[model samples]
Target: MKKKAIVLLGNKGKKYEYTRHNFGWLVGDLLSEKMDLFFRNEYTYSFAEKRIDEGFIYIVKPMTFMNLSGQPLKLFVKHKKIELENILVICDDVDLDFGRMKMRPFGGTGGHNGLASIVREVGTNQFPRLRLGIGRGKYGMVDHVLGTFSKPEKELLPSLLSKATDAIRDFFILDWQELMLKYNTKVSV
Candidate 1:
């Protein structure tokens, strides 16, 4: 079976924990814990792996800061010998409303620094990606992304993250087209 990679675009350090910029990491961390996949610090990521059928799923959290997310990702993919097509990058998107998500087979970076870095490092924007919504309001982009979830959002984040986790699992069990048809929308879980 082909080895697949699920790269959760995020940064390290407790200071960034639970921030909107690192929410993708929360989903990866939660899903890994729930699936009993323990992560170990290796190379430039907090890496976890699990075997499903004849294939393997590698869940990774890049240790580098957000804008430079791809540097570590490029290294990790090369080390694993996984092709760009066989990977999905899960990241936060400020264009959609909070809790919403969208998936694309490939496209331009949409002004996202982390994605821009990934596109540059991987030498292509033709990789699959799942972007979680983190919409901007009256606040500036930096404030919106660096800010914490609201009171209601704090309560909602766990389930949302869990649903996102399920989405990752579905990436393996179901076809990519099916997964996108079902999950690529602004609807709540």
Candidate 2:
């Protein structure tokens, strides 16, 4: 069987930690824990790999900052010889409501810089993605994505993170379409 990889993009500095933009990192961290994997610096990012029943799963936290995430990602993909369909990107979505997740097979960046970088480097927006909603309101779209979550938002974060992690695991067992139908929702699990 072939190995499957998932690349997660997020900022590198401490200032970006816990911010809404780091939601992808948050999910990656949680998933790493659940899978008993630890990240190491490699290919311009912090990455971890684990062998699951189906194949190897890789979690990447890009060190190239948000806007230039695709460079490292493309390198990793080519070096590992993994196909685009085997890659699932997790990112924060401003357009989605808080706690909601959208599983897309392929689409535009939807105004996400990290995603935009990926599309640019890969020359297409045809890979699958799992988008986590951080909510948009008083903080405005820009501030909301770059800002830290509120106390209430933090309270609901763990559950949502767990669900997103599960959704990714489900991707290993089911195709993106099936996983989206079962797990995509506004409610927190």
Candidate 3:
């Protein structure tokens, strides 16, 4: 069977740009550039598709605001007939240190509203997820999530994003166990 996956971006518009919440979108932008796919707005989401040798990859940025991300996600999944295992939700995580990443086959929302929306829409948390860490700031959790990356964090983003893009590719090329062993950790940025 063809291996298919949907990569989700977490926020929308100028208001949320560069905020920690948009890290998933940033990663998707990088990958889209690398893959040479340009997104076009459709069905309340911005999306692009690329067909690689193995299967198809879909990159999605839900126009739905952060708290209601699941609407477009569920619509896309159902419209495309994609299985939960084939979907990989990418979002920012405050709990991890900046520049770190974690991948899990299934889990709870980890207190992220976007994730909670997804869990609610899907009716299960069995899908894979790529959690990109945007460490907390001095102000506190809310402030940190709402804030953009600092100068140092901005400097580190490309390398971290590169690693993340590679992880996504690895999900296609290698088995889950191998990919997890190779990539689930902090890497030098």
All models: lDDT? Answer: 0.85, 0.86, 0.84
- Locate the minimum summed-lDDT window of 10 residues in model 2: 180-189
Clashes of each: 0, 0, 0
lDDT of 2: 0.86
Show the colliding residue pairs in model 1: none
Which pairs of residues collide in candidate 2?
Answer: none
Per-residue alpha-carbon lDDT of model 2 for 98-162, expressed as tens digits?
98998988889988999999999989899989998877768467787788889999899999999
List residue ranges in candidate 2 displaced over 4 A.
none
* Per-residue C-alpha lDDT of model 3 across residues 1-189, encoded as one tens digit per residue: 354665666667787788888999888889889999999988978889877776677888889988898888888888778888988889998888898898888999989899898889889889998999887779888888988889999899889889999988887778778877877877777
Off by over 4 Å in 3: 1-3
Provide the TM-score for each candidate, comma-separated.
Answer: 0.94, 0.95, 0.94
lDDT of 1: 0.85
lDDT of 1 at 147: 81
Return the TM-score for candidate 2, rounded to 2 decimals.
0.95
